[model samples]
Target chain A: MSEFVEQLALCVERGKVNRESLYPPDLHGQDGTDELAKQALEQGLKPDTILEGCILGMDRIGAKFSENKAFVPELLMAAKAMTAAMTHLKPFFQSGAVKRKGTFVIGTVAGDLHDIGKNLVAMVVEGGGFEVIDLGTNVTTAKFLASIEEHPGCSVGMSALLTTTMVNMEGTIKAIKEKYPETLVLVGGAPVTKQYADKIGADGYSPDPQGAVAILNKKVA
Target chain B: MTSFERLQNRMVGNPVDRPPNFDIMMQFATRHIDKPLRDYYLDHRVLVQANMAMLNDFQLDIVQAISDPYREAFDLGLEVSFPEQSLPISTSPLLREPSDLARLTTVDPVNGRRMHDRLEAIRLFREKVGGCTPIMGWVEGALAEAADLRGVSTLMLDLFERPDWVIELLEFCCEQAILFARAQMAAGADIIGLGDAVASQVSPAWYRLYALPYERRIFQAVKNSGGIARLHICGDTTLILHEMATSGADIVDIDWMVDYQKAAEISDNDGPAICGNFDPVKIMLQGSPEQVREAVINCLSIGGDKNLSAAGCEIPINTPYSNLHAQTAALSEYYSMA
Candidate 1:
């Protein structure tokens, strides 16, 4: 509702990080998410309100990406802009002034060293307002289970770019559901599909980062 | 008909005994010979041995030197590590900063360790089955090599942030690919497979500006060397299929997500041969032999005579032997009846 919050949302949606950053040429030399979020907070706006604006921006870019109106560059820039704004809100989050929706544990399954897809999903999910525990690439079943144990009730997401590593998703998902039956497990990658996801007994599968956010949000809701 | 004759006839739209199978097998071939993936990627003898086994066992028409994307990057001085039975990893990117492009230098394919290994694979294939089957040698497309050196996420941002620097890097990568392709051709490769997998992640406009020109250059070099050029970009490439058709390649691999009918319709009537549309995981690794046969027939029907029977990408290492057999078997059965 506030002008500063709205401006911050535009900066994130358009990927304008700061006045010094020259991307999105249309927003050149203007105050970006870094300044606008600071301004929004200084003016007494709630951290939650600012976070809502950030998530709104991410949602817009994600929608555009899914429709082919945007691509990885646009999404990465938006995530970067969101990250810039989130820095000012970190203190609030630390002091119990801001609360996250939930935790999402994600990784590229074992035997798959590719992390681009896994990283993108982590960024988008974090931008969608969740505490993301990124386990990095080549994450084995034990690491995933340990993370789940540490972050109880956290939704699990696995990615594998190679078809060879995709089979690892099955073993990891089976191990997780057997131990944490109620925890939602999602899988995705270049080779992963809804059919493969279902065959592996995964709770959900997404083809894009934005879709991954939507799935996590729906389950959390 | 000889495998080479079958492929040549299919390329010219001539009737063949059956569609020539062009399945990309990397890890699958490695597992076939009971060799570690590390050996398959590093040793030409191991790669050639595995491929020869594929030719003998599956009646594969093409023997390929595609092990991983890191071959050129590793030779380019990137610190790439090879696991015993896993894909290579490059944790520390060579170009951590845009200015780091200055430090990058081109390596001669003959002298470069990994690139030379691929050429050796082609030479061995020529020695073993020179006149019988086609031998495909691979090089990373300019954009893909750039991503390998600069990291995918960082290079993606560089496309927007440092356009000039990205162009410089692309030009350097393109030159290396052209030289590598020409060297492979001279080493006895019948076809050169250029993989620009990163192009699928960018917008069509960026692809045209940053990736397409370089791909055209590399493919043109392959053609100049009397080698058939094949373009393979992984993922849903429907958005850029029209542009890809004009990239000077003889064959353009269509990933499973792109509709076979749509890809066929987009290419020029005299365009590159279209090869694939089957899901490697669903139809080959997970599906029964019956499903594999059905998918092969369906793709052939949609892709018409210009189609090559193959999976969308590499055959998964664990795909059931029966399902792998079903693809070529389907073609033989259907075409025999026809």
Candidate 2:
């Protein structure tokens, strides 16, 4: 762990996006994840190593979130910081010089407009090394099926905050299974239960984002 | 004793004849009226009809002026869309820019469309149920109102990126809550409910710092206005139980994720009298009548024999009439033994 990588990890964990982005006042005016990642690449640190830093940062925060030691704001900030760092690695990923884990396509089910949970899961999954195609909130079943068709091997995820909208997960899962039975579908939200997942025929359910990451890894692995 | 007398007695930790039942129901009421659920929000007449019908049918306590959370945002002059079959959506968030906060004006609840609709509901509830039943007026707390006005994501980031602006926004919304509570209380609301569901999203530290003080202020203001305050935060609020207890509310509605018995223990029966903590969806909606009765009994023992019986939150409308009736059986059966 060199200075820059350590600094980058620290930045991601504390949610410092750039030198001027003053979130964690302790590191105010310090080079954040964005600057540190760029400097690391310039200093000949491999893109994979920098990405490992991002993953490490996310894992630390994600684990804390699982333990209830961190809440949505902290996890969200870390994700924002991770995104800042990932911007530097995007070109390498595009050029095939960097690789990613499997894709995870996620959304809030139709008639449910909440994206906070879906966004949190997407960020954590992306940090876990998956290429996340976030379909955003109020996503219809047709949109989900079309996304799965476009990304044949992608694992599907859906979220719903409202109890009224949670039932839609059942229909969406059934529709997906009808078209692509082999595709894995995951469901979660405040209202969703493992029992409900079992009832709905969803392949998996995770209460927290890191748990979602672990489930995605199991499927991909 | 009537249900209102039991609730009034229980508010101060007095021994009631039996525990009183108090849960919010929109779905069950919607089914009773045979109208679109959307009508409940759009028409105060329909809202009152549904509420009165549920209370009359189930013999439940609390004639409430509660509806969706966005009514305050709508009253604040943000354009809100009511989808025919879906929840209301605020088309434009009020806090697009920090400057937008300054441009905002206070909402006169009597004059604002949705606020007046709720005021009308409160007046109607009072006229219908009056002194016989406890009537509750609802208001969204700072976090919920802030999220409504300032998009939730933006509000989340603002906590870190724009702390000063977040406070200002919250303070603005706090005043909004105070205004809403004041108006509702003056309009014959016996118990004013402050629903800050998003308070659970922040850490206990953040909640204590940013959210709790404002909540205390709102509750205090409600008290000054001669109104009882009810605090309801809609998630697992285990970590902040002690702080919630200190907010000067007459009752705090616990969610299903938390153990009501545990909450009463943690607060030493000194916290606002605990209401709720039952799984509305599971017990009231999905459970058989026997299960609902057993649940109420379980709550009585766990919450130390003196608390209001409320669902973990709101009961879904589709819950069977038998299960809803079973909610009342808990109280009657307990009294029968006494």
i-RMSD of all predictions: 1.0, 1.2
- Expressed as tens digits, the lDDT of each residue in B1-338 for candidate 2 is 87688888877767777788788877668768897878988898998898888777888788887889888898787778887767787766778887888888878787889998999988888888888898899889888899999888788889999899889888989998999899998889989999998899899999997889999999998999988889999889999998898888888889999967678865464556888777877787668999998987787667755578888898876788888778787778877875
The C-alpha lDDT values of all candidates are 0.90, 0.86
In model 2, where do residues sit more than 4 Å from their true spots? A1-4, B266-269
Which sections of candidate 1 miss by over 4 Å?
none
Residue-level lDDT tens digits of model 2 in A58-128:
98999999998999999999999999999999999999888888889999999998788999999999999
lDDT of 1 by residue, A1-221 (tens): 76665777788989999988989898889988888888777988888887988888888888899899999989999999999999999998889888888999999999888888898899889889998899998899999999999999899999999887888899999999899999999999988889889989999999998988888889879
**What shift in Å separates residue B291 of candidate 1 from its native position after superposition?**
0.6
Candidate with top DockQ is 1
- Top candidate by TM-score: 1
Give the local distance difference test score of model 1: 0.90
TM-score of each: 0.97, 0.97
Write out the backbone clash pairs for model 1.
Answer: none
The digit string of per-residue lDDT tens for model 1 on B1-338 reads 99999999998778999999999998999999999999998999999999999999998999999989988899999999888978888889999878888988899999999999899899999999997999999999999999999999999888878898989999999999988999999999999999999899899999899999999999999998899999999988999999999999889999998988999875447888999989988899989999998999999988977788889988999999999888879989879766
